[model samples]
Target: MFFRIINRIQPCTSQQRLLSRSPALQNSLLQQFFDDEENFGKQELRAKKRPGRSWTNEELRLKSSEDLHKLWYVCLKERNMLLTMEKAHKATARHFPNPERLDRVKGTLKNIEEVVHERNDAYYQLETGDSASAPKRTVTSFMGFTYEKRAEEHYSPPGEGQKGYEVPYLDDDAYLMQKLWNEKELCKERDRKDNLARRQLANDEMKHYKRGGRRTFDRLEDLKVYQ
Candidate 1:
């Protein structure tokens, strides 16, 4: 059956040859397919087309594993649908409606993942020798502070001491001396400004006190109050 299907895919016909020979025609067909699929998927997944409230916890609990798997695919399709609508909106200078629907779908998917993970964890802990969880470590850097860490795997080993890739801290005496000198200068400048401001404020207050002292008390009533 697969051989028959394979045989059905004929070599380039004369018309197909003519079409392929023109790069413009070939590109147009490719672009048409791309645009059509994008629009079709968006239309299919639009909230109006699928119209329902958010998934309920009861619905999730009742779902079989296979149904849950299908739901994941549906969520993925919905996300792609939103993204397509967004891109189309940007292209045509229009607003994409109901962006919140995407977020709601995402939250639903995350809840589903959590439930799946809980099940997987329980199963692994029961059957496996260890829990299938990420490994963690405590690491210290040049400044000398330890912190909990996670490991990352790379397809290729990273180049050590590569410029721009890794920058090491300079803890040399010369660097430390320069840093201390800069700090001292900044501190001295700040102190000088603060002192000048304080002196100006004190002078203003003293002037106000002297002016008040020289004010005449013309009223006999005020003089009696002072006495």
Candidate 2:
């Protein structure tokens, strides 16, 4: 299946595309900085068809490397275009059309990157005998518990030639204080639950009484039957 997918992929291009501004948008050299001339300072919003949703990870996974490369640029251009129009609108005190498009564009870019990373990891696993996942290290926490921690990109694992954190020693006094606090919290929670259950029981009893031709309880003490 992997070989078949690879065979279906087209050759990726090496040329870099311009951001936001397409070649056809260039009426003059000065217009290259913006997406399009009509995009800037357009206050009136046209209630035409809304934009489509972003490319999902599953859809991107089925695409070829060449398709992903082109898609990345398309999303990048859209993000840039959105930013440009937003800035223009803000400067002129006008509303930007479809402000949510920026978020959608960013989501699409993220999906593309995730799909590309999956492919790269698969390729690495096929060629090399290891996965291309982030590096993990076993480290002991301040609570004296050991766990495997995955290191993010451009970050080193904690306690790896770094100044380890200083945890205050737990003495008898600290233990007693923590125990008291836990007991107090537990008592509060129990009281809350008991109050809620009592209230519910009273409400149910009142409902039953009303159905039995009793409009109201004789006294406040009558509602304390649960006690």
Candidate 3:
């Protein structure tokens, strides 16, 4: 298990040696918070066996829920270890090597999370005809940016004795202002798209031009190609 890690770290000058800890310190329960003591002050770290890619969604989908649960903790632990090692490297002013391994661990964890969510959604759809995710509604801010407002749990309804909570509504003047703002924003978006299209068409026309700023044509008949 440790051989892979041991192989990655190369010793170098200028950094303090990491092997002087007492044997009794090995029994400390918090040792997991740091990398293996031998790993500190290493010059470089490379993954053993060199996993070329992160876990795939298709592969993860085939695993049972229990397997996914275990895999999540495994990735989480590796992430924590890698981060701890990174901090140590920074403290010693050493370059943290093979940083992509940390990204790989994180990607695996994300894939596992998405896979679990997909399974939960499918199960909820089969049983209740709705997704397992929180309900959200789109709301436009006063500044005209759109955002999804997620539903939150509350012990009591939002009325009567609830002084802090109330339904949100825009006043008439604000409503009309926002409506005008939205229309202007929509027009701006359409113009932006039209501008992009016009630019792309111009680029296409100029791409084949020669050094003299004229496109090649075998004969006058070939000019009809553009038409």
TM-score of each prediction:
0.45, 0.53, 0.61
Model 3 residue runs over 4 Å out of place are 1-25, 28-31, 36-52, 140-147, 160-170, 179-227
RMSD of candidates 1 onward, in order: 15.8, 13.9, 8.0
Scored by Cα lDDT, where does model 3 land? 0.67
The alpha-carbon deviation from the true structure for residue 160 of candidate 3, after best TM-score superposition, in angstroms, is 6.2
The CA lDDT of each predicted structure is 0.55, 0.61, 0.67
Candidate 3 TM-score over all chains jointly? 0.61
lDDT string for model 3 (1-227, tens) is: 23333333334532223232333236565456456554555455445534467898999999999999999998898789789778656655567767787899999999998999999999999999988898776765554445677777679777784333222676676578878988999999988876565454455447566222336777998554344
Model 2 pairs in collision: none
For residue 80, model 2's alpha carbon misses the true position, in angstroms, by 1.5
Question: Candidate 2, overall lDDT?
Answer: 0.61
The candidate 3 region of ten consecutive residues with least summed lDDT is 13-22
| Cα RMSD of predicted structure 3 | 8.0
Rank list by lDDT: 3, 2, 1
* Candidate 2 C-alpha lDDT tens digits along 62-100: 889998999898778768767765775565455666777
- Superposed Cα deviation of residue 195, candidate 2 (Å): 9.9
